[model samples]
Target: MALSSQTTALAQIPRVHIFPTAGEAADAVAEHLLATVKRNPKSVLGLATGQTPRHVYAKLVHAFREGKISFCDVETFNLDEYCGLTASHPDSFAAFMQRELFGLADFDPRKTNLINGDVQDVVAEARRYATRLKESGAVDVQLLGLGTNGHIGFNEPGSASDSHVRVVDLADETLSANQPSLIELTSVPERAITIGIADILHAREIVMLATGSAKAGAVRRSLREAPSTDCPASFLGTHQAVHWYLDNAAAAEIG
Candidate 1:
């Protein structure tokens, strides 16, 4: 299927664009996000991790230091985390977000929320997070990075479209590709804690960043596949406002 034909509302897909490199893509996305935050200083943001979003975060940090943006009035909620890891774990999503984004921007620790993988009562923690998001009046804009398996925010293959805050078994392929340095094929974690699809859709706008040749196939599938749980990122096309930013490498299969 063609990307434009994958969803019903192509007119509302926000804007899709391809840049020469990830850096150029990141700069464009960062500029828009920072402008939005500036317009509404108290904006609530949904954040994602992985290599694709690193350059975007770097640009945001630069904006922060250069007096172009401020996180003092911003509140952030992360997408997911490994089920059995602590915030301090080197490979933990929490640590990854801190090192890649929050720490660089000096965002207040209290204003940022990440799923606690170490929480003893997993269900309760998930519920509390959902409550927190609702209390914040939902996310204004969400940043996403697609997995090679077409998963988003840990919503892996077969993940229900209405799936909500909960823990799920990480698809072996997803884990292996995501953290190959720390997890081998056999040692990959079986479970992960992730925000639900409903939560992501609650955002007023969504921005997904994709980079590298490894992501080309998934990026193509996400933009062209039918809106089914099998291709999690495909659901974004159904969202009211979704923007996909891609580098040439990641957009290779677009045609």
Candidate 2:
């Protein structure tokens, strides 16, 4: 298909909307998500953690407080978590999700699913989480945030395109960048458990949020690179329902 045709098809697959700034992008995405929940009260949502998604979570929280949306019947699965941290860890992805999203929404704790990073048999836990996703009929929509290195859900450089539910050592740059908040580079967990590229691809719809000039390079690569494991986010180009919600700064190179 032609490029415009392909973009149109992809938009139909989910919905891609670009905005002037991160806040606008977040607001638009939150509106769409709330509409989906209203239409299908039992929808399963895939959640992602990170600074990029902060505004989206804020908007969702505002809507909830204003009685504009309800998530009581929604089910959620978080994208990744640092492998060795407990849910209580300040820097853990679990805590991030709670502080940023779930705590703000009305979703029941029982309906939310996050990979148990503290599980003794990590491999088995990963498998069980994958199975639960399948049994729950997969995620109706998945929210995503891209790393500056082009990683998505901790699927780092050189990860297999088809890999699923696996443990991976965080890239050096990933650890270094997070050092400040995490106290030290050594304090950052070397490994993490994440949903596989395949699992993320299987979601019914995907909403990828990106912002800031810091993300410009990876955003460009994610849009321009050939679908390859070298840049995990490039695999998203192959996804039928992937929507890139980018701020102007992030989309500068693409434009």
Candidate 3:
């Protein structure tokens, strides 16, 4: 559990925030996001899609409906998308965003960007997405959800530290972990187009959320272990301004 030399040299000791319940943790994250938006109406947000973020998105939707926030001027970029799935596909990350957040919020469709998972040439798509991210300046806040295997944005185990936006084959653990989430697709996706670990690190700030006992081990490893490709999320420890939001269950194994 000792910090690696590289991680020790760069990390400022990430802030960990634990809440009594998952909803409470989500509430805190929502407030932080709202604060970021208030500080910069034109803020570019790096967003995540999954069960972990559903509550956060719901809170944002409620905020929008209550006249507390508006995403009309905010631009967003999704973290990853399953390959071979079109934006409109029911199981696609784009569809998840629409169903969970974008459809209910005031976000402008033109300003929201996501990788074309079904593109004929995934390499070109990766480059295009990366270029768009660069043109937007730094992301004000990058929201993340931990994978059971310690990945962030599909930056699976063995991913290089300097990796950028690219297409990656999904690990078996990832596929198994995500299989239950897909209601429409009979089979899980084997590959994904993801914004790389390096790109995620470049964001001005990062907010990672983990809830439930299912994520306890991964949470422990990510925070207590040294930075390594074996646990991609471990690399977040090297970022100077990363915040971890966990419910008691997810934080169970951390200490």
Candidate 4:
């Protein structure tokens, strides 16, 4: 695929590390994340929430408990949140972060920010989140997970590569993908607030984790496809530095 003004050639892409198993990939990724954070002791991180990062969060929490990592100085912003849900809702992203990382990690609530999805003024909240990201400076490292559809954050198919923080309509697959275990797909929110492709490109570094056979096709397309709204993550090839960590299942279709 030809490179557009927005994307770099695939040959220039760097730092992809594939592993034999999901467990191995998670461990390596956690080491890279924690080690990078230890160097600064106070990094502004762009964090994504989902099943892919569950083990990585467990690693971080374990380190904090063992006195090997401290999050008191780390500032974090989540990539997206489901609309109409309060932070305390069991299915909310805020609650996921609380259950997955913060509660055990001693992360300061004052320094951790999550976009309020239930606010009446969702657009205003998105703009405010963008402002907070700018003030925090370039995210030291953004931890992301791929959707089976190749979307990043909530920038689904046809999302502009230059998109920024905004209110987004959830794709049909995205809604189903986020549906809780044993829960009806109709129960998931149809809208979300997400930091867009451009917002993530501003990060100092980007690390994306993809595991399982379900993500194999999307993972391959994300790297092989040229930068296009059709595959928003394909734009990552344009980034100066991006680390793609894939387990065997996710890397199955890729060379």
Candidate 5:
């Protein structure tokens, strides 16, 4: 909802805002997320991991410490996880959320849902996670990080628009971008379990954040180009309540 009054629409898109700095954009997003929690204590949050949301999570953690919010009634579902890493792995999305948000906040362990990537039956795990998501009623808001290759939640460029949660082969660009330095290059995960585009669109509200010049092209295409699987983020244009938060660098390629 009007988190920042300094909003502008691009083409037919809704609520696109370009902040002067990444910190400002992140602060606005954190405030918006906290507003949702305050309005609905039982809100189901669709969370994301990566540099894009790191600052936002920090703000959320600060709010929890300042008694501005409580996650006692909030439930969280992460976007995706590496297929080979254990939840305890330092590089895993689960561990990242723990270190960045869950560990710093007051979230209930039982209510925090993350795909366990170490399981033997990855397909069954995906289905099970999807069922859990469906049982949650619906996600109040979904936070997303745009990949350089126009992916979201590890849903690669060629992903189906109507696809559901599933295990997907990681695109070369994605693997390269996320390759852990501590592990051998060959040991890097080649697959990930991600919620599908359909699941993401089901959220009542979507907040897509992109920063840095590397994201400029994807951000431009997402808002200006036709909705196509070639740029998975472009499909976000079809959602009625999508808000885009970008810094000047990310918005540079936009006309």
Candidate 6:
């Protein structure tokens, strides 16, 4: 309940904050997330992946090491995972979390949940994942990183609104942006399992982060353009409580 934000007249305009640097924004976000953890010891949290959250998680890891925060009572669900990758794969989202946050902090292993990209029954896994999310109730706060193409999770352009948990084809831009994990562009997985737009909107609160000049155009389009399947991140504006955190470079086009 602490993380639940009241509805506002921001359906077409989302609250935005521009930070001088990515480190400052990440520290701010870490403070907000830690507040939720302290407010409700047993909160359910949703997390995102990619380069944007790297700093945020680093800040969080520092806090945990300093005894400023603890994830021992927090349960987490990741936004998506690349298809055909295993939990042990260096490129997998699970591995990313393990290396960046979980491994460095006091997190509960039993409480951490992620989609298994290596599973053969992708549809069934999606359905099961959706059911689990529904049963857990509204995620206290969902952390997101904007894709260069306006994708939230793997809900690429043209993704259906009614789309719940499902396996989806990756956009060319999304695949390229994930190059850090793959050996080469050709090694990037072409598919992903993701929670849908509907599920994300149902979250109690949504916190999206953007940094670097590469995201300037996408950030502008997502906030200025109409909310449609063409720009999945724009849908966050429709949510009652959402926070948009952008670094100066990422906010360059937001005037």
For each candidate in the order shown, give its overall lDDT on alpha carbons: 0.82, 0.82, 0.90, 0.86, 0.89, 0.84
lDDT: which candidate is best?
3
Query: What residue pairs clash in candidate 4, if any at all?
Result: none
How would you encode candidate 6's per-residue C-alpha lDDT over 1-255 as one tens digit per residue? 122122223322446766778777777788779888889989999999887898889988988888877789999999998888889888888998999998999889988989998888988889888988899899999999888888999999998667788989999888778876563235688988999999888889898888889988889888888888888888887788988877778877876
Superposed by TM-score, candidate 3 places the C-alpha of residue 239 at a distance from the truth, in angstroms, of 0.7
Candidate 4 local lDDT, 1-255, one digit each (tens): 111232223324457777778987888789888988899889888899989999999999889989998889999999999888888887789988999998888789999989998899999999999999888888999999999998999999989878899999989998777775312235788899999999999899999999999999998888887888887889998998888888778877876
Q: Of the pair 5 and 6, which is ahead by lDDT?
A: 5
- lDDT (Cα, tens digit) per residue for candidate 1, span 1-255: 013322223324347767777788788888878888989998899998777787888889988889877898789999988777889887788888888888888588999988888878888888888788888887999998888899888898788878888888888788678665462233656788898887888899998888889889998898888898888888888897888877778878875
Score candidate 1 by TM-score against the native.
0.89
Model 5 spans > 4 angstroms off: 1-13, 180-187
Model 4 alpha-carbon drift over 4 Å, by segment: 1-13, 181-186
Per-residue lDDT tens digits for candidate 5, residues 65-136, read 999899999999999998888998877889889989999988999999999999999999999999999999
lDDT of 3 by residue, 12-70 (tens): 44478777789988888998899999988999999998899999999999999999988
Residue lDDT tens for model 2, 114-153: 8889888888888888888888887888999888898999
* Every candidate's CA RMSD: 4.5, 4.1, 5.2, 5.4, 2.2, 4.3
The global Cα lDDT (0 to 1) of model 6 is: 0.84
TM-score of 6: 0.92
Better of 2 and 6 by TM-score: 6
Report backbone clashes per prediction. Answer: 0, 0, 0, 0, 0, 0
Supply the global lDDT for candidate 4: 0.86
Model 3: per-residue Cα lDDT at residue 16: 80
